[model samples]
Target: MRTEEYAMHDHRRLGRELGLFDTDPLMGAGLPYWLPDGAVVRHVLEEYVRDAERAAGYRHVYSPVLGKRELYEISGHWAHYSEDMFPPMRLGGEEVVLRPSLCPHHALIYRSRSRSYRELPLRMAELGCMYRSEPSGVLGGLTRVRAIQLNDAHVFCTLEQAVGEARAALALIRRAYVDLGIRAARFRLSLPGEGGKYVADPELWSRATALLREALDGIAYEEAAGEAAFYGPKIDVQIADPAGRESTLSTVQIDFHQPERFGLGYIGADGARHRPVMVHRSVVGSVERAVAHLVEQHGGAFPVWLAPVQLLVLPVGEAQEEDAHDVVRRALALGLRAEVADPGQGTLGARVRAARLVPYVAVLGEREAGAGLAAVRLRDGRRPGAVPVEELLGRIGGVARARGAELWEAS
Candidate 1:
């Protein structure tokens, strides 16, 4: 397809064409339902991030989606960001609101027990679901949804450890983007300026901003004055699409006010209690937005590991049905996502064309079945010709395991 034609494979169109997701007006705008294929992709991505977090010494936690209205008030979000949050719902005697961020909840968890300096750098991670009252004019597919599953985490540490924690967070974001073949278009140091949206304490803001600068020193980034969050200064990693539209995919913020506001503290080596500095970070900002980016980045042809259907077994005719089923069984045993195309559904060419969206397709016929082999065809038009079943499995399995971006090394 021409580049212009291929650009039409935007997430909205591809989501419908591939049966990935859907939306309904009756249910509500900005809410999406993930179909089976899309759910598989989501599951894969979520597991990948979970494993990465585990290896990084992050302790995962599950927090409620709703909290008392006073919780946000303590976090200072009620005063600064009330316009973006869903209205408080009165349940019985208490007013509850859908949580707009996980920072406050994590802070509450840290404050639940007395902590010491030895446990200073506590990393809390969650796949937290949040709701925001986004304006109808700005809601666009998965990119700007009302509900989001944020790959959020918070690090509570002493002021001395804050810079290292920020660096660690940035490293995680770099590794994730590299593995997923995403290009970091630019780095932005968003700082507070004359805007009244920022926290009122100038001294706290100055300290937080200085720490962020020290952590980001030697890193190539441009400063954007007046773009900081209400409670902190942040480093935003912006990713550009094929059309050069940029979106913030990863962020790390240094927060000083929220910790003090929430009265979160740990006993220092001097035997004095001091508030712990909080570092807020997200490697893949929002899982839904990540999916949208990947869908457009790969043009619906995901990497082997991320593809909903990694392989398709197409029998030339009904005579090779058993062979096709056998191939699928073997593929499944090897942990490959494979499906057998029904020969009775349509012509072999038509079926192959339809299944071309999948990464690999194995064609089985009387010649190949009798020879105990199958002709492997790659979607990228690389025909490796007839190969033994075991070799085919090994090759594709290796690619899936390695999460290779290309079908053939030469290609």
Candidate 2:
């Protein structure tokens, strides 16, 4: 697509132009409803995340959206995120609340198994939909929402292997982010404040926080006092957009207390009972928020792979409609996201130009469909011409599977 054709304001104009999702006052403003197009975009992101995670040895799992209040009381969620959680429901005298995170559910899953040391460093992931009770005013398009689906995971490992697993997760996150087009990064190693801002044992906090620092020995860091979870230290990745605005996009946290609280244990090498350390990470934060960042980062030109509609065949007129339809049908059959533009809408040049302005779009008509070729324009700066379908498919697949900040060029 031509660089000059893309609107620089597209990042903010997403809600107005794409209208992928919307929130209503009567339905409670902070929540968003994903339109068909938005769902397609989100699905693209999530599938990408799943493939990345699987490559990193993560096993996916499904957990409940709500848990008993007692569960949070045990995992420290109530003390830390109660304000962000939905009010508890009295279920036959027991309190239940919508979950704000996936750690507790993952811990529960661990407890359900009588794990051996061989299963040490067990990594479980979930792209499951979760909920919180964020205030209405905080909601902004896909950036903030009361309900969200997270790209979350938990790694349970022995104290000795904790750092190694953390480093692996860090590498995994970095790989994903880099492939997705992230460039400059801020690695914030979070710690406890001086006067006991955290909820765990003070000495433990000091020792654990320092341990994290040691793990970050070579990497540049900014210390964030009181920015950690109640039980441990965290490494947060804050991304810089083209406009220079920064936002926290990914996080990896280590918890020393929660596994013990739930008695999630396994037999050690010495045949002794041992509590595993838990590392909770949400590499993409929330799909809602991640999409917001992506919109801003590339200014809505979501690389060829992530584009909601991979290609838009612009037929010159009614005479070319059959060819365009054939192109669209073949693209769909091959599992590619492609569509056809309306010839009656405007001039052929105008239609082609409009399609190019979107993240990923192509003009496939008369000359090429008959020639069994595709006219391609990439989100990165490639222009039209004809190419074999298999060749184009392979390149597009590579782009879709890519993760990280370097995934796309800036607007």
Per-candidate Cα lDDT values, in order, are 0.90, 0.75
Q: Across residues 209-242, which tens digit of lDDT does each residue of candidate 2 receive?
A: 7667766778788987767776777888888655
lDDT of 2: 0.75
Candidate 1 lDDT over residue span 1-411, tens digit each: 556865686898898899889999986989998999999999999988998999999999999999999999999889999999999999999999999999999999999999999997999999989999999999987899999999999999998999999999999999998788888999999988885677899898789889999999889999998878999889999997667788898999999898888898899999999989999999999999999999988889898899999989989999999988998899899998999999988898898889877988999989999898989889987888888988888888888878777685642
Give the range where candidate 1 is weakest over 10 consecutive residues by summed lDDT.
402-411
As a whole number from 0 to 100, the lDDT of residue 78 in candidate 1 is 94
Top TM-score prediction, candidate number: 1
Clashing pairs in 1: none
Residue 14 error, candidate 1, Å = 1.0
Winning candidate number (lDDT): 1
Candidate 1, which segments miss by more than 4 Å at Cα? 1-7, 409-411
Score residue 42 of candidate 1 by CA lDDT.
Answer: 92
